[model samples]
Target: MSTIPTTAVAIEPLSISDRLSLVWRIPLLVIRCAANFASFCLSNGEIARLDWRQKLAHAYLRASRVTLTRKQQAQQRKLLTGPRIQGYCHRYNLEHRAVSVNNDTLYKKRDIPTPVLHFVKNPTTQPDGPTIFYLHGGGYHNPIKEQGHIPLALQFAAACKAKQVVFLEYSLSPEQQYPCQLIQAVAGLRYLLEQEAVQAENIVLVGDSAGGHLTASLLTHIVHPSPYAPPIDLRGRQLKAVLLVSPWMAMSEEQIKVLPRAPNDFLTRESIVRFSNMFKPGLNEVWSNRCDMHDAVAVWKKLFPTSHEHAICRKAMLAVGTSEVLLDSCVSFALECMGCETIYVNGQSDLRLVKEADFVLAIAPGEAHVQPGMDCALGYHDGKMMKAISTFLEAC
Candidate 1:
């Protein structure tokens, strides 16, 4: 087993100064929204492809991208922390607990605050049932949205009948870089095993976009220990499952630009590269190269060499929309997980054979990035894809 860190990092409260700064940006935000609307109107082809709901969501995300800087978004995220977040949980009748993790062994810098593990549980949740370790995705920069992320978490908990949901509030990028978020995640997982007494086999790692990238990073660290981070020992056990939603698997700018642009998808090449650089400054191609289609099989073999050492998990599901910008990479990664030969062709094929395999690939037709979760946040349930996800998790 990995050694747990001895020190704990405290959660810093947001100051009045931080809240005051946001008031001045309201006018600018309005201007940006108007500009985004004009751009949306001009893109007739893209608009034609999207449903009414997707069109509005795409517009909102685009405006948000321009209106708020990552730092501002980070500051706004502070409002959702502590008692505020707990209050939100109360509305759903879910219990909330905050656990601060020690980062003394994880980082040498004292300024980098320790990560927080937000434990949320439904009233009907079973004590010894499955536990979800959720990692929110915002390109490793933007703060989690109360309306979007909180509801999405509740949906997952309901879907799997989870005993508890552990959301890791890891440090954001530009301020904190690679291995910092990675190590903090390891620290959070350690807390689940050592403190909470949760079995490794009952833990499910669920992450969206960049969180999905972090989830994959954790798996790699398990197979080959990172010198910078503490190692975890599963005690001859494997995780219950891994569910990645619209994962940002590829980091290469050239590779990402080469992929066919999905008009309805909100992601852009420029935004992806900018976020990737913030997460890993002076970016090297070594990490991104591992995701290449030609090397996928070899990479998966190295990560999950044997059944006993199943660092990847006992079962896996990779869900991506047919209209996602990262569709190619997501599909490739899913194929690797299934240990199948990589197929480069565009439209869906025999990938549905995943129903018979331990690794499943779910494609949401006519949807955009992280569509199901986004839809859930909008109070739209009853999606066929989401039901499939619930069925998959229950079976696992």
Candidate 2:
């Protein structure tokens, strides 16, 4: 996608007044978008009172046309200038167990297609178990910085006693756009499938926010290509499970209205709008062709470009916060998973409907938007969240 502005409307930096207008005006479009979105959250009685027409009208006022180029640049710059996120080392003083860490390959090479850096943690004997294909989230813009998500991955590795954990640093949004990110995700998973006789059922795809959305997308579009979807071989590449936190699954005019808009905290409606434009700065040409959610034929066509690949569906955990604006949509989307085996409940999700779900748990303190590890920074209760997640994964 080109970085040049498509509109000749004299591109000028937004000013205070201009931003104010945007703050008020943009909500209309978002609200309109939200109205059209399918509501799997409200029950038959609750939905009866839900005002669809009003939500639809409001979303229209805030929606902006998706741009092509500038979005890519913004996301790129943010990623380049972000802080060096470092995970806590397992150098035990009195907290967690102390273990010797050895991963000299950390930052050894950057040009590699996929870089798996090590996190500082007590080195437990590697367990003979399934592997985890970890995908970090950055709203399609930034990804887990070098060693950023290491702490979380290391914890999972210890609990599962897995042989290996591959952190696929897929190119972020904006620059990579839709297909590019999906391409790498598919390629990365496929690479693992080919390298070893790994059972598709043993591999878990883990992530949060945009990572969760990408996970859902991979399930929706990859196995079955839409008219606009690119070509990819998704044969025999199975997954054991999908673990997502506060995953941003569906994006449309309707869903945007109901998105969380808190600031400097979990998710904010305002920031989401801003970042939404920043990432995927341009629409994927492939998506334009077969992008039909409302159309039954289109959705069917979009979902399956080829014969059923027979990819065994994985058990999934879709966790969210109680106050999350996306709470409704997230749970709805989870239920719609073509072959969802299990759905673990989060406090946020339970606030809505609890159907076809296995278990529901309360939200931990200080738990903000979809964070996998390093909850201590946010003052979140680590033991409760992680223990529940691990238990759910182990049960299946």
Candidate 3:
């Protein structure tokens, strides 16, 4: 498919409030990281002792260096096209080659060509270790590469003593819609189980933002598929756990407008609508768009189909920052899930701590969307989220 041209928008000056938000964020991140490291030490003495201090330090330093502004985000949107994303992935590969044990690209070989899957195994870890199937988020239109995120993958692998990390580079929207990405995900899952000979019990599914939505779809399909949609035969397999970071699981154009704005949120209501439009057919175009013939919205409804039945994984963990715009939606989704209970950590009462008897919701105060991943690696409160994810995965 031909790449769609992205129109560049002129950078706009930040409002005074936005400027002050950025100024306050730097020190806040440092303070939060320190507080979180201390909390980890207190709460998880054994895991904390396993060289997380260095990881925490690295995350803090990185958090201080990268700050996203409206202008920068606008510029970023311009660079999310096919060729630019291809180049971005190339740069990621070049940059992370030194740390990666084995980095190979593989194709899913679907009817419609899907994006390449970047599989990076931990060089130091022994083979047949646990695997994390990671999906990066870019609102479904853009994708961040594994190179950008492999450090966190490595950190998880090291801390959990896991073996491999597979980053699925699924096809984006306006080019491929709905089931294309989902199909690619099932195919990738099949590869891990069948080709790599990895046991399903040792596999963990992790995704951020739109990637989280995809992950949710994959899990729900495995657990209870929509009768209307084509089934993904899991080959009698299941995953150990799932971790969703700021998942856009049940988003609506109406909900986006009503969501409370966060100081650090790069996602805008318009962007959400625009991205949704790419894969989700509008009321007027539902019949016209071939991808929507099977009804993607129906599939989404099936995925979230009553929070009560949403616990597809044996164990699940959700992390969202209190300051993120998606906090309410994420919390609501968690609360609706079966057997979920709310718990408070660190006296952050405003933070939603929804958990099923088996699920974990790690709410980081004053953090915003997708902070624990490579893009916001070492950002404030990320240490907290990472600590939560590590603890949950280890327990599972």
Best by lDDT: 1
Q: Candidate 1: list runs displaced more than 4 Å.
A: 1-55, 63-84, 109-112, 281-299, 304-311, 337-357
Sort by lDDT, best first: what order? Answer: 1, 3, 2
Residue range 1-396, candidate 1, lDDT tens digits: 111222232335546775566676677777766665566566645344444555566666666666665555555544433343566787767778887887674466534557788888877687777999998888886656666777776777776788988888787775677767777888888889888888888999999998888887777666656665678777778888888888888776666677777755778777788888878722332232344454454556765554524445787777777668888888877775544322221222433343444666776565668876667666765443455456567667
Error of 3 at 303 (Å): 8.3
For every model shown, what is its TM-score relative to the native structure? Answer: 0.78, 0.58, 0.64
Cα shift from native, residue 58, model 1 (Å): 3.2
TM-score of candidate 1 on Cα atoms, chains taken together: 0.78
lDDT string, candidate 2, 245-299, tens digits: 6677546544576655532133556556655765552233323221333553344
Better of 2 and 3 by lDDT: 3
